[model samples]
Structure formats: C-alpha cells, structure tokens
Target: MKKDLNGKITRGTQRTLDAFFDAMTALLQTKPFADISVNELCERAGYPRATFYNYFEDRDDLLTYCWIALSQRADSADLASVESSRRVDVALDAMADLLESNTAMLHAVLAHNPPDGPLFASLHRFIEHNARQLMLTCVDRDRFDLPADLIADHYANTLLLVLDWAYLRGHTLTRAQLHDYVHTLLRGVE
Candidate 1:
C-alpha cells in the first residue's frame, strides 16, 4: 500500500515536470525569457503557483532544468552505442536531427534579447563531455604524441564552435551535409 502511494506520487511529479517543460517551451517561443513570469508559466503548465515553487526555485532554475533535459536527450540519442569511427557520424546526425526537431525553441533561445548564461553553460558542459569521450575513443595514444587532455580540450572547443556556427547560420547544412562537414573538420586531428 505504501509503495503504491509512493509510485503514484512519483508519477504525478513526472507529469508535472513534463507539463512544466511543455509550457516553458511554448512560452520561450513566444517571448524572451525576461518577459516570462511565474504566473504565466504556471498558467501555461496548468499547475498551481505553489506547485511551480515546489519544483523549481524560479524561471532561471526551470530553464536550466530544461537545458539539462535537452542535453540528456541528445546524449542518449547520440552516445548509446559503442565508440567507433562511426560515432562521429552518429553524433553529427543526432545533432542535426535535434536542431531540426527543436527549431522553434532553439530559434527563440538563440535569438533571445539577452543570452541565457546558465543554459549556455549547461550546453557547453554537455558538448565538452561528449567531445572528450569521442577524442579518447578515436585518437590513438600510441601513434599520436598529443596529451589526452589536450586532445579532449581541443575537440571539445572545436565541437562547440561548429555547433555555434551552425546555430548562428540558421542550420543551413542538411544532415548529410553537416555530417560530411564534421567528418572533414575532424579527419586528421589525432
């Protein structure tokens, strides 16, 4: 009986979080983050004001959570397989797909009057972690004299730069085109 009650509570919490994310995504598309208020978010989420506070400290906190969730979704889609030469291709495709799927939300966030610092930081961390993992997998330590940490850092920065450029340029490249571009950029950098 107690376990059943706990499960119900957990399910309700998950539903609330889902509602919050959906509402926030919609709100971000329509207005800058600064203009969005707790009341608006609560109303859009169809949850009480108190329920919003129970889950998040404020709008920024909720935005950070949303960013993290996006990262996790990307990571899971891109990195669930074993590392190989094909990993880069998989990741590039996943990134392009993410951009395509979240076009409106991304456009809103990217074009926000004032950039969201926490969201950018979260995205940076996600890219860095994945880039480091890819570097460690693809670079041969014995053949290349570069330090692993340096290689990781370089790849991470390069990956973020590529992503920023694509976003700023409005994702002009198709998925296949971006895949080829990434492969070309990363080919001999061991």
Candidate 2:
C-alpha cells in the first residue's frame, strides 16, 4: 500500500499515484496549488475521481508526498556525499544539475505557486536531521563549541536561506563559487 524507500509503488496503486503526480506536475505549471481541483487532477491523470481518493486524501497529501520524494532523492548518497561544510556547494551544484536536467519539470513545479509551508517544513526537517548527524559524526561532542541542537538549527536555516536565494536568483554562481560562498558563510558563524 505504501511506497518503499526506493519509490516502488505497488503496481495498481503506483499507476494511480504516478498518474496523479504527472497530472499535478502538469497542472501546477498553469495554476496555483489552491486553484487545482481533485476533479481536474483526476481528469489529467486519466483516472476517475474515485481513483484519486483511493490513493490520496486530497491535493495537500499529494504535495506532501512529492516533497518527501524529492527530499529523499536529495539526501541520497550522490547528493549527500559532500561533507557538511561543503553541503552548501554540493546542494547548489546538485540543484543546478537537476534544474538543467529537468528545466520544464522544475519550472512547472515552481510556477504552480504552491503553499510554502509544507515544502519549507520538509526541507527544514531534512537539513536539521542531517546536519545534527553530521556534526555528531565529525566533531567531538565535549569539544564542540555550540549546543548540538542549536548548531543543527542554525545550519538548517542557513541552508534553506542559501537555497532560496540560489533558486530565486536562477543560480548565477558557478558551483565552485557557491561552494566558496558557503564556506565563508559558515566560517563567520561564531
């Protein structure tokens, strides 16, 4: 009934969900999330309205799922391999690569004018969790100058801000430049 970490949706359920996402992605390009209707989603997905209900309670649930899916991919080894200190640059490069690879899809999602709450929350949680874990692994807890919780929170917020800036600015900086900027930003944190 539920998808695995690998994103393997059960056959019947997967098809419906896949269609739903496809439709949502398509519709998002033309309208805001609030403007998209379940009926319209069903129509785009080529499934009946009942089919949409069978998978998701509503559009919000689908949006949450999409965020979770993207977070998972972002946190995977390919993207996560960069050390915490370098995560900013790594994130920038990865995002740029993704945007370039799927410009249309990214544009569609961003154009949708989706509510920022769920997306922000999802990213905040993911970055906080990873930053905390990375700090624990790399630094001696007793020697650490800052509270673990505080450090994690700070890093998470910084990452989010940097990402938002980059996204809004259309990623003008090169990957190396972005990496240097992140290092400078982190170094300044006392």
> Which segments of candidate 2 are over 4 A away from where they belong?
1-8, 78-96, 112-143, 169-171
Candidate 1 ranges beyond 4 A from true positions:
1-9, 75-83, 108-143
The alpha-carbon deviation from the true structure for residue 124 of candidate 2, after best TM-score superposition, in angstroms, is: 7.2
Cα-based RMSD of candidate 1:
5.0
1-190: candidate 2 lDDT, tens digit per residue: 2344366556787677677877877887788677889889988989998777766777877776665555555523443455555554555555545445666666566655542644445444665565455443443235457776666566555655565556543666666665666666777563
| Strongest candidate by lDDT | 1
Each candidate: what lDDT?
A: 0.68, 0.61
RMSD of each: 5.0, 4.1
Return the top candidate by TM-score.
1
lDDT of 1 by residue, 20-113 (tens): 8889888877776678999999999999999988888888778766765565566344343545556556666665566667877777876663
After best superposition, candidate 2 residue 109: deviation in angstroms?
A: 3.9
Task: Give RMSD (Å) of candidate 2 vs. truth.
Answer: 4.1
